[model samples]
Target chain A: MDIDQILDSVSPIHKDPKAILKSYIKEVNFPKGHLLLHAQKCEKSIYFIKKGIVRAYSNTAENEVTFWFGKEGDAVISMKSYIANQPSYENIEVLEHSCFYEMNHTELQKLYNEHIEIANWGRKFAENELLKTEERLISRQFRTASERYNELLKNHPHLIKRVQLSHIASYLGITQVSLSRIRAAKN
Target chain B: MDIDQILDSVSPIHKDPKAILKSYIKEVNFPKGHLLLHAQKCEKSIYFIKKGIVRAYSNTAENEVTFWFGKEGDAVISMKSYIANQPSYENIEVLEHSCFYEMNHTELQKLYNEHIEIANWGRKFAENELLKTEERLISRQFRTASERYNELLKNHPHLIKRVQLSHIASYLGITQVSLSRIRAAKN
Candidate 1:
């Protein structure tokens, strides 16, 4: 879907708000395995996924920890760097060849200032992102690995097929072997 | 600070925006140990702390997990419940006698629709909350207890004095004994 259609899907914005968004947002594409952002680099833009999947992760000395995955209709941004205006410790990498409507952070802020609907959109977008992060944090604190795996199966079964088991395990804060065991038990 | 001064501190909004916000927001006080919001209930309002501290936590069969703390100038809300419009699984409790500017979620939404600056403020507020949640998630995923403790000391040392050590330990995802050891070693 184009920007107008996507905006309509959420809430119908008038021509002025749509025009402001379209002016600042540009369509972009990336190949599979592309790093949209790298650790220690600042993220200057937000991407609204039109197609494919992207993963956000950080690394330790031993391995990388996958924390977030964005798919079609979702907006992806480095919350720390985007809000705090600092270098990100996480890398945002494409899991599949992806298409996105990309908006520079500065331009988006300008749009927010220029239009009320756009600002409301920005607020809703941030709230949605916050809700996702809070859910993940709560799951990590309270749920076991198997329970988390079950939640993934129940809520986002497509992720199991699209993402690698290793990445899924990392996202669940469990080892690949443990994830395998969970899968085996479920099957 | 009153609503006007608080709004001025962020960015000088005109009287229209300030009046709109003030109309929706009401000052309220809670005695120490009050549950501003209890588990399994919907959070109808967001609180901006004028004074004192608040703790947000969830409980398992075994124990309560303290996840967040809000102090002066902070806005506290249950992101998942507030954004998703569902009953909260966590509890928001007053840690001390507190004063806050509280705004009903529905009224705040109305204000966002009626005013551009208010929408901008809401957007910024959500972004700030998302940043904090992301930081905590990253810290939990990547940092050790001792490292997290050091970060807390460096960033929010006053919390150590104001909050109970047990709650602080829970926030760090460590046991009270481990926190005592860390403190003893530091001393």
Candidate 2:
């Protein structure tokens, strides 16, 4: 999808403002398994995925727990780290060979500083993300493991084929064995 | 707490911009048990509480599930409903007699449209909300029930004194019996 289209989808921006935002966005690539961000390191950039998948996870005492998946056309950032300007508690890794448009902190600051429309877009985008995160929180708090699995399937069926089952199990906060049982029962 | 101080803490704006924002805000009062928002009803306003508490929850087939508590200095909105311009899935109610500075949706849009600094502050505010929601999502996904209870105690010890045990149990995603057990174990 076109970058302008992605920006528009995020929040409509006029042609002139979109052009300015486009100027700051730099295209980059990553191989599968590459760690785009590491726990304890500060996040420096926000990425908009042009293609492929990335997983955000945190290393707990026992294991790595998957938090979310960002796929084609999704914007990915270690939001906590970026907003706080502190070291990240989570790591982000490419799950597939990925193409992205990255805008570093400085560029993002500049965009907000220079363009009111862009700033408005940023607010709307963050509001959208907040809503999504709240929904996921609600699901985790209120839904059964099977229900969460079904939700994932209903919302992002493409993720099932694209990422490993282990990652999905982690995201669902269920043991791999339990996930397998759920899948078996469903079938 | 002073409304100006709360606004400053959220994101600072200069005198002129602050005046513009202040003009759009209107102080309102709600008695305890008043429903600020209801499920299936579109949210019309965002509120900055100057005093007292509000609870956000959703009614499921079996029961009402508490999602969050917004206290003095906190901003409360049916964010999903406001962002999507649809009926809310959650309800917000005054848990205590409350005073708030309310800004309706159209007024918010006008502020964003006419004031660059206000739009920038809105972006910063949304980003903060996103980070907070992400933290809650992570906690729900990874923490043990007891751990979650401890987290709430650690972060907002005052809430225990303000709200009922049943509400806390709902927020923790545990049954009242389980919560009682957890509290007993902790004691």
Candidate 3:
């Protein structure tokens, strides 16, 4: 996405492109398999993807669960740890060669302090993140593996293409074999 | 539980106390049993409690789960719906007589746009909420029912005394009798 698109995602109603683009938000490029963030490290920044894909996942004794993924025009971060300035439980990795604009925690705060419209934009975006997390929690509670798989596909079709079957299976709280069986049954 | 304390929570380093006090926020009172916010209503306000207890919960045909509880210094709202401007799945109710400073979603924006520090404060608080939800999700997936119950008791012991047993049961994903048995065993 272009700078305009990024700015729009930020504050559609209020626009001051020049002021929002300066300082902390600098663009960075990554290759596939790049680990943009590490698990258990304090989150220092949040990223906005200009192109390509990023995934948030973690390894367990058994498997990896894809908790979140972002493509173009999306924000990516270890948000929990980022906000707390504590160690993260999840990692952010590039699924494809990607370009992102990075905003350090402090710079973002300074920007918000400097510009009310920008701060409002940040607040709304955080709200969106909160809603997403809430929905994930409820879905995990109420939906079955197959149902979850379908919902995931419905909401994030791109994730199906970018994510591995094993990761997808864990996210659905099922085994890889069950996911395959469900796929077979569906077809 | 005072306004400044709540304001300080969001802005630790540089806070504009009076600016936060403005921004369409109004001080109000809620009696026990008051429904501060209802599901499916379009509300713009979130409450920063000065006194008393409030609950955030959702009812299923089968049960009700306590998603969150708020007391003095906590912000209370139908959070998911509040952000999305959609029908809420959860309800916010006063569990005890309470006092709060409230502002509509628009007022929240007004504060953020006019006061960057307040906006950052909002982001931090929202991030805290997201972290709580994420941890709860992970716990639901990984922790045993007994473990979760222990956590609730440890973190919010007052909830055990204040909330209904059935709601607690639902939150723990167990039956009322089971909760009763557990409580009896513990006592």
In terms of docking quality, model 3 is medium
Candidate 1: where is the Cα deviation over 4 Å? A1-5, A9-12, A180-187, B1-12, B177-187
lDDT per residue for candidate 2 within A136-157, as digits (tens), equals 8888878998998998898889
Interface RMSD of 1: 1.2
Arranged by TM-score with the best first, the candidates are: 2, 1, 3
Among these predictions, the greatest lDDT belongs to 2
Model 2: interface root-mean-square deviation in Å: 1.0
Off by over 4 Å in 3: A13-24, A59-64, A177-181, A184-187, B12-27, B61-63, B177-187
Root-mean-square deviation of Cα positions for candidate 2 versus the true structure, in angstroms: 1.3
Question: Mind giving the per-residue lDDT tens digits that candidate 1 earns over B33-96?
Answer: 9998878888898878888889989888899999888778877776656777888877888988
- Residue B66 lDDT (model 1): 92
- Pick the winner on DockQ between candidates 2 and 3: 2
| lDDT tens digits by residue: candidate 2, B1-187 | 7878988887888999998888888999999999998889988998888999999998889998998988889988887666888888778899888999898987878888888999988888888888888888888878998999998898888878899999999998889999999999976
Docking class of 1: medium
TM-score of candidate 2 to 2 decimals: 0.97
Report the TM-score of candidate 2, chain B only.
Answer: 0.96
